[model samples]
Target: MKIIRSRSFTPSRAWGALEIANMNGITTRLHWTDQPYKWHVNDGEEVFAVLDGRVEMRYREDGIERSTVLETGDVFYASVGTEHVAHPLGAARVLVVETQGSV
Candidate 1:
């Protein structure tokens, strides 16, 4: 078992990243920050679990684009080759689980 305090974690201009645990096939973490209008490219499928506050996700679809808001306890997944951007809503926080190994 491992513990990571949110405040103790570092923040990045693009997005804050932290490794809460890396055991077996599960990689868990609590990542939070105030970065808006930035696109994120994931090489593999990843799960973002909202822990607190809110967030807005913008992504492109079949010749169309869309945006959605996710609140506490809400979850979303990003698949490989999917381009998307996200930002926090009033100091948002989330626990992200990367099911597919890093690229």
Candidate 2:
């Protein structure tokens, strides 16, 4: 059980890069900045909490374009194996918590 304050978090320079916090079974990461990117297939569930600013999650699957914009205090839950890319609207910051699943 650890506590992370806002003032203690350092901002990121680029978009794809992530700042990780608790990396036990539950991994916490922070995202700052915006750029075009893609998330490859993975085997873990991801949870995102919008700490400050605005962010957007974009993806296209099955010939469909999907996007979700998150503001301050917003949260999103992504299942395992789901592929998507994240973009910040304006120097946004988001907290991501990843959990591993059994095989």
Please tell me which predicted candidate would have the highest lDDT against the true structure: 1
At residue 40, what lDDT does model 1 achieve? 61
Residue pairs with clashing backbones, model 1: none
Tens digits of lDDT, candidate 2, 22-99: 456776666656554466544677777878777787766675779999889998777775677777786666777776
TM-score of each: 0.75, 0.71
Instruction: Give stretches of model 1 more than 4 Å off.
Output: 3-14, 24-26, 99-103
When summed lDDT is taken over every stretch of 10 residues in candidate 2, the lowest stretch is: 10-19
By TM-score, who's the top model here? 1
- What is the alpha-carbon RMSD of candidate 1 to the true structure? 3.0
lDDT, candidate 1, residue 69?
A: 96
